[model samples]
Target: MASKSAKKVNLLDHNSIKHILDESVTEVVKNQGYVEDVRLSNAKLLIGTSIIVVALIAQFYKKKFPENRDFLLACIALYVLFNGLLQLISYTKEKNAILFTYPPAGSFTSTGLVVSSKLPRFSDLYTLTIASADPKSISANEPVHFTKSITGWFTNDGVLVEGLFWKDVEGLIVQYTKEPKKSK
Candidate 1:
């Protein structure tokens, strides 16, 4: 049998091992990112509807409130300007996609990857893309978790961007950071 001092040292080692395992599990959960297929489709639909609604509102005000044309025009202009500004801010703040050259076969957390760029476009509806740090080389059906900040911007846009991040995660690139800047 081991001596008392040796036993004590073994106990300490056991405790350290437990601590490390616990930390790894916690980190895995924190790094996981998931977005469902339906959610992504819904986001695209919602953004499309928003654009249509804005256009209709502008048209209605222009015709119905002709006497107050200047006011309505100002309102519409402000709406468009503000909307574009908000979208721009969101694009800058949110994560984009991880274009994979190959897919992954197992699950992975978004701790190792880096965020390269966030692309936002305004043609018909708002769209965003996030590039990843590593080249695409993953296996099929790989599980991926995308870690992203979800507190700022409009929920619709945020959710859309979040879903995009998740899709990229599925492709085996997890772009997440523990320190995300908070917009004031």
Candidate 2:
């Protein structure tokens, strides 16, 4: 797959973009270059451990808080533990893929979109970067910090990406990251 100079990208179609976001991460990971990020595995485990410590402290010392607080602490500990376990699974796959990949998948409907280009810094192609924005939210629209400069991080708006449609994102990826001829 070679990166095309004239491929076209569609940024206005929020519905189609949402459809992709709604699709299972598991299905998307079936393609090349899609890795399950476990960057916070250690952090999540540490959080769960801390919660357990708090729970233990609550049990050991009575009346520092209410009796119900003890139960609440225990419940929070359990929830964090469950999430930590799932993170551990992702961490193992980050080591190497085995049977399959799964996500503690979540869904949140957003109301807007933000599209930008990652030109001059990380990519040589006029690669596209998109983000979902919530029209109703009052929070900042700070861009996500992404590491590992890859295919989608380019723009001269250099590559028009003509002819190809946006639904074929995977194909677009193939076009952009095709292996060099020397390898063949």
Candidate 3:
């Protein structure tokens, strides 16, 4: 009877120890996977930013030098095309949505307005409309009157969302009108 009792105690202790070890291993694996994902995401963002910078520089060169304008313009076009394609690839791989916040009142003109935002919720669709008193002369860096409207749930409080409509310009062009929440 004493031997049998001892055997049962040893078996239970062994099972308990095995369970703890398994749990610890699982936790470690999960944490490592999360870290790897974060690193990959950061790398992608950096690559995208670099491409955009290069494209901007090429555009500036195209505009500033008229004698070599053709060459610079070609470079600018290629850069924009390549960077856009790369951005699309990254977006598809990450399954990330785009977010854009409207600009505050009194800070944008029809020519100067650009909108962009962080990744939005997968289910949300954002539609932006640009209206101006004079529509024909709309271009970046030019001053013109405009109006914008947006519809979405505000997720983060106090975080200014940045966005770009044109490839090069960045700023707030419209403001959101917050609706009151209904009491349940």
Candidate 4:
């Protein structure tokens, strides 16, 4: 019952939610001079998870199919290896981006904005965390997060958000971060 008291933003609308990501990136760039500094707990997790998966797969194959263990192991190893290399390449490409911790977003890890660069097709997912300084609107102390994927080849593109909502995002960011507002 208490859950109904606090409203939450839908995390599935790709178009509407894209506003948060675009505005946040704009806020950091237009106002902060393209500052790119924030902690991202997700990248490390990606590499770490890859290692753990390879180990787990090896264990599974060793127990269930010992007859063809080496061949299976080699195949799994190649797959994980390919994924790791992709992650590394994506990182070097997105060094200009910044990350922030938005709790309600997926794992609260892979959410961020790319400053001054085109959105890369593989990595650096954007998260929508709408925070407020005013106590009246949806969120004041805690931020409201919305998320949609534009990270892969299938649906990735420039984040397009409505102008009115974008203005709201700009105001919220400036209100909290003390950055100057970016004019529309």
Candidate achieving higher TM-score, 2 or 4: 4
| Superposition TM-score, candidate 2 onto the true structure | 0.27
Better of 2 and 3 by lDDT: 2
Point out where model 4 deviates above 4 Å.
Answer: 1-31, 38-42, 45-49, 52-64, 67-98, 101-166, 178-184
Which has the better TM-score: candidate 2, or candidate 3?
3
Tens digits of per-residue lDDT for model 4 on 1-184? 0112222234455544444455445554344333333334355656667777766666666545758677677867776785777677567644433343232233222232333223334444554453332335333344444334443212334323334334544555545443344599
lDDT of 1 by residue, 79-178 (tens): 6765785576447533343222211224353312322222222211222222333424331222234333322211332122233333443333333322
The residue-by-residue lDDT of candidate 3 on 1-184, one tens digit each, is: 0111111112223343333222332232232221112444566677677777776777666446768777776767777776777777567533321221222336443321122222223322333322222336432232322222111111133111121222111121222122234599
> Candidate 2 on 76-138: residue-level lDDT in tens?
767677677767755653322211222213413222233223324323333343233332454
Residue-level error in angstroms, candidate 2, position 130: 8.4
TM for every model, in the order presented, reads 0.28, 0.27, 0.28, 0.29
Candidate 3 lDDT for residue 24: 30
- Among the numbered candidates, top lDDT falls to 4
Decreasing lDDT order of the candidates: 4, 2, 1, 3
Q: What lDDT does the true structure give each of the candidates?
A: 0.37, 0.39, 0.34, 0.45
The alpha-carbon lDDT assigned to residue 145 of candidate 2 equals 22
Q: Which of candidates 3 and 4 is the stronger one according to TM-score?
A: 4
lDDT of 4 at 44: 61
Residue pairs that clash (backbone atoms under 3 angstroms), model 3: 99-117, 102-174, 103-174, 111-139, 115-163, 115-164, 116-162, 116-163, 116-164
Over the full model, what C-alpha lDDT does candidate 2 score relative to the true structure? 0.39
Q: Runs in model 2 with CA error above 4 Å?
A: 1-22, 62-167, 175-184
